[model samples]
Target: MSDRKSNDEAESLLAGLMRFTGQVAGGTLEIARHTATMTAMFGEGWVRQMLLHSMEPERLEAMADAGHFLRDARETAGLSLKELADSLGLSDKSVLEEVERGDKIMPLELVLRSASLLARHDPVPFLIKFLRTYNPQLEQVLEQWGVMALPRQYERERRFVNLYRQHDALRGLSDDEHDRFIQYIDGAAQLVLDVMQKEKAANSPPTRVPKRPSPARKRTPRKRS
Candidate 1:
């Protein structure tokens, strides 16, 4: 009778263990299924945000002064202080300097000139940001274009490509002319790539030196029979 009672207790314990194992397995499967479903519903960026939500959020820089923005835009377009001043038809650099130093607000004509000169450098967004403070309607226009979320560099590149395609010179070109145009475009692309590579190399973090592997022991070759 005692032997039978021991066997019964062992069986009951084994059954409970099996049930607990099943519950754990089921829960793991359910979690995996839910994760897959979520991945399908939302993109990887959404999933990444969820995983990183507990970390410190990114801090956005305060909007730059309008004058500073213009200066930077001019520099990005490879224009010097004097060149920009001359382009604006100023006799001396004092006005440009004063505007850049935030000592004076830019006049409408100067602002328009700056925009035209900096067109290839994506000056619109910065201009919009600066103008919106005084003109509320600009905010609505920016919202319509979804420019707030788009990156400035990407927008600039997109605009450049679009303008290149729509240029009057590109329209109605013969095959030979088209080929020459493509070659010119290729040269321009190379120049842009070189500049970008130089900038990236300058700004990139220094690479860590890799550990040297241990030298292998010299082995004598065996003669084949």
Candidate 2:
């Protein structure tokens, strides 16, 4: 009876030890899995932040007051407040005054119209100054994209005059011929512009992130005879 009791006690102890070991192993595995999951999530977030930072345009910490620029442009154009208001089709100078004082937020359409009017007075200088004041990043991006070199007012006028002269000269040609000629000219111009843009982009600095390498697989040991 004593031997049986000792044997029973030993068996119970062994079973408890086994259960405790199993629980420890399972808990360790769960903790390891949780750690790995957390690490992966952290890595993903870090990568996303880096990507966004790299891709986002450089922005001003504080934007210039739109009204200030409008007021300056108006003054530079040598227009009186009343005249500016009248040109904009306002009944009175109250809106202009508010804008000039930076007390009221101007609408995008009004801002654009103001810029256009200023551009008529001084195209290149006004555009450069205005864009730099409002959004320097846009100016930089446009320059990088190779679209900043727009035709001047005189150049556009000359182009239209030349087009008219050419049309008159080609009046003797058939209508179909004239249409084909115009299409060819347009296609050729577009092709040239496309090529120039492609070259510009190619020359620009690359902004892509390097890819991460995959983990190597563990090799299984060969069975020995």
**TM-score winner:** 1
* Pairs with backbone N, CA or C atoms under 3 Å apart (clashes), candidate 2: none
- Model-by-model lDDT, in order? 0.63, 0.59
How accurate locally is residue 125 in candidate 2, as Cα lDDT from 0 to 100?
A: 40
Tens digits of per-residue lDDT for model 1 on 48-73? 35633422221101112566766766
162-186, model 2: which lDDT tens digit per residue? 5656545676878998899889979
Model 2 lowest lDDT segment of ten: 55-64
Give the top-scoring candidate (lDDT). Answer: 1
Give the clash count for model 1: 0
